[model samples]
Target: MRLPIITFGMALAFCAVHLFVGRLRWLDRTPRSRWLSFAGGVAVGYVFLHILPELGAHASTFEDATGLDAPLAEGLVYTLSLVGLALFYGLERALALSRGERMAREGRDRPHHPVFWLHIAASALLVALIAYLLNHREDPSAAGLALYFAAMVLHFVTADFGTRADHPEIYDARGRWVLAAATLGGWALGLLVELPELAIGCLFAFVGGGIVLLVLKEELPEDRKSFFLPFLGGALLYAALVLGETYLAAA
Candidate 1:
């Protein structure tokens, strides 16, 4: 009962967080690596501790409903997740290269880039759709939803860092609005569209993989200067929060 509203609020909260990061002065003064590391850790932790377990459960349902062997259904979903992960990784790499080439060729400060807009447009849709999925669950609780909210807010923040690095002017002026609207749009879609059990399972599996790719791509760096303590601590804290939720459910 309360969970769905909270989930919707969290979705809106994500948009608000993005807005603040884009316009506010606080994060500008902080060491971004520490914040980014924490975000990446929380995002990864949510995928492993919460999303994967739920995916496993949904896989069984998928098998039962689809007349496929349980193992086969699980394999298919996992494959989808891997494909999603690889697809996004490839997109990010390609976009990076393309942006570099354009910058080198132009030899001037470019205020706008197509790749940044394309990437954020796609990312915004994904984020919103994921939020919609979260709320559409048959039985949602406030605690579980709160964990997702905490994780995704950080996740989006990490993403914003990349957006700002690539195109600060464009992102500040328009990119944030697109993402915020997408969050609300996703909630609307969830209310209007209902997916079959198998379909829902597969969609989430896909998202699970994408989450892994996005986080690792940022957290792992060639220079090896990525902060580890905040990352590790955030993961531990989120994991504890998840475990506490499970315990509360059981008790």
Candidate 2:
């Protein structure tokens, strides 16, 4: 599908960004939190990849279908995808800054941090609801759910590049190198295992990589509360645009 191309590109972008640049140290969270984040991602994959498309197929409404469309379906999908993107971005940024603050404090929790767990949980549920639609009845070639799962997992793993280190709160150049290695390694592995899915897998990594770049340059201290709103806003903007494009194309 045409949307797969965009999805593929975005997924690749996520990986490439991390492969070359490395993750910012400030963004990593607790190991438990990270696992939870990954779980949340899996849930998201389950929904978007497995369930959402089914709902979209029966939507009979522009808003409902956009979320389902692989490339462009309805306005709501546009909104949720972008919002989800923004929330993910915001969490990444928050983790980075929190790490920096922790380092400055010499390993103390930051007061008044954003509610990341809630965000992750919410994201997981949303994805789960969507994934449920992809019952075990869908065709093989139309296997978009698997692709979605790949994208989400890769994104989650790539995001680790930013936080991986002796201490996520502390900055280190070596972390970037490691991230770069992971990115390339991931691609290589993708090639060896499933050459066909390789393209889409790499695309997922690319999007993660882009996110690393966007927040990598900003010092941890500078990316505080103010960054949250803008990040969400950007996601919303992308969703709106996606919706508009979908409508125009469908018309």
Candidate 3:
């Protein structure tokens, strides 16, 4: 299904990006730092592409059932609809964060390199390609996927900016919780109104919940939150859920 294709492509892309980052020689400089940076890229990719989408879909279904009029695109609505309503205004606050934005704002606070921006542009292109592939068929379920993409984009932006500004060296468990809540809470709200797919929603929610717990592993003193952990966990969860769904469909 779409999940497998998305997962494989993401994994491939993750590896490629890491390889590129490894060549930086300045940012990574050390072997351990290089590995960590690569790991972070992989984790970010998996979360944005996989786990977030599933959560968004579930939320969309829930909203449709409960008749909350959360703005379903195709009997599939998104928790993002709620966020988009806020995002429009939230940007007005002007956090003076976001490295990309900061670069533009400072007019001269530019980093002594182009590798980061190059990587970003490359990532945007990759995401565009992935979106093109995934954006076919405006069915209810597909609509859910679309919403997931939007929500994940926002989550990624927030997490990227937050972690980068507040704790460049350490991971932010607080931000992770917020991300989880935003994603899960959105789905839960959607589900409240959309019960037709309750069973399916429950299945998705179970997987989503697993993702949250797995992410919490980062909070553990011993676990130390590798970038790979979130990605690997999300990929495994998605792969397992997709397989299970396929088996059931076949049966």
**All candidates: TM-score:** 0.88, 0.32, 0.27
- Expressed as tens digits, the lDDT of each residue in 136-238 for candidate 1 is 6633776776777788888888777666666778778888888888888887777777877777777777877877888888778755356789989889999
Model 1 score (lDDT): 0.75
Q: In candidate 3, what are the lDDT values of residues 183-230, reduced to their tens digit?
A: 333333333433246445543444343333322322222433344454
Off by over 4 Å in 3: 1-113, 137-233
- Give the per-residue lDDT of model 2 (tens digit) for 8-88: 443355444444423333344433233333333343333443334533432334423234454443343334444545656
Candidate 1 Cα outliers beyond 4 Å, as residue runs? 1-4, 24-31, 108-112
Clashes of 3: 11
Task: State residue 89's C-alpha deviation in candidate 3, in Å.
Answer: 37
Q: Is candidate 1 or candidate 2 better by TM-score?
A: 1
Top candidate on TM-score is 1
Question: What is the TM-score of candidate 3?
Answer: 0.27
Q: C-alpha displacement of 139 in model 2, angstroms?
A: 6.2
